[model samples]
Target: MYKLKTKETDNSVIEFIEQVEQPKKREDAYRLLDIFAETTGFEAAMWGPSIIGFGKYHYKYDSGHEGDAPLVGFSPRKAKISLYFATGDTEREHLLEKFGKHTTGKSCVYINKVADIDEEVLKELIKQSVLFLQERYPGK
Candidate 1:
């Protein structure tokens, strides 16, 4: 596997976000930065190339695949915003229903526009996802 260039929790990610072209996207990114900072109790920093991540967790699997990654984070991709929760939450389906226009993947929640969703509800979603991961993975 190619090695992750930035050492998992570096400020490089933050710098990358401030440089996004779209004004709305930049504002949305900062909003996420504030929310994640408060919720995860870890300072918001960049993870990898373009992800705004909160906290850090080193994980090891029975198969010996072990490494460190952000506990909670999101990336503003070209198509949409991708948020990583690190665990599967069945109840998240309920939130997404009222979350306006959005999509869900295996362990991520995606939103096209921040205007299409409730900011408060979105914060709760992040909180719940982080808690679920904490319960499953135990500490970062």
Candidate 2:
């Protein structure tokens, strides 16, 4: 059986943010924490070591790979701030069109800083991600 590496931990989100070497990144992380918490109406929790996540849902793929993951999250990495969102949400793509400066991975958006992106769009992405995941995973 395969186990997920990025499981949620009891680590303090504030402690993690404070450790970010870049002052701007650390400040942006705190801002993101506040924005995500306010937008999702859920308490922030540490997902793995770096990601500050809000809410969670369990997922089982057709291949039987199953795990619980944060509905929305972000990590202020050395290179960029990575924002996690539902992979196939069309609304996410639409919102990103107006989301200021950012890059995208399959399920993550990378931004240099919080000021590089539109905060309203970020909130919408977070909202859509939670809704999409909840609908996809249902009661889980």
Candidate 3:
């Protein structure tokens, strides 16, 4: 059995943000917190040690692997901020075309700073991720 490490915990999101070493990243974390919360309509919660996540869904893979995860989340990392969104959504890719300056991984988008990306596109990503997960998982 594979173990998942990024489970939601009772950790404080504010405390985590305050502990961010870089002042600029700390400020961007605050801004992103507000954006994700407002856009997703879900309260922020700590996902493991770093990610500030909103909403949640449980996914079971074809290999029988399953776990609960946030619908949308972001982390202010030492290198850059990582934006988590739904994978396999075509619309997500389309939106990213206009997402300002950012790089994408399988499911995580990396941005240097909040100011480097368009706020409106960020909101759209949050919205699309939440919707995609809700539709895919359907009330998990």
Candidate number that wins on lDDT, 1 or 2 = 2
Better of 1 and 3 by lDDT: 3
Candidate 3 lands at a TM-score of: 0.98
Q: What TM-scores do the predictions have? A: 0.84, 0.97, 0.98
lDDT of each: 0.76, 0.92, 0.93
Which candidate achieves the best lDDT against the true structure? Answer: 3
Q: In candidate 3, how many Å is residue 113 off?
A: 0.6
lDDT by residue (19-52, candidate 2, tens digit) is 9999999999999999999999999999888889
- Deviation of model 1 at 3, angstroms: 5.7
Cα displacement (Å) at residue 71, model 1: 1.8
Tell me the deviation in Å of residue 35 in model 3.
Answer: 0.5
Q: Please identify which of the two predictions, 2 or 3, would achieve the higher TM-score against the true structure.
A: 3
lDDT of 3 at 79: 98
Superposing every Cα of model 2 onto the true structure, what RMSD results?
0.8
Ranking by lDDT: 3, 2, 1
List residue ranges in candidate 3 displaced over 4 A: none
Candidate 1 lDDT over residue span 1-140, tens digit each: 64546446546755788788787887888788888888778887777667787777766778776677777888888778888775657767777777777888887788887888887877777788777767767766
Of the two candidates 2 and 3, the one with more favorable lDDT, higher being better, is: 3
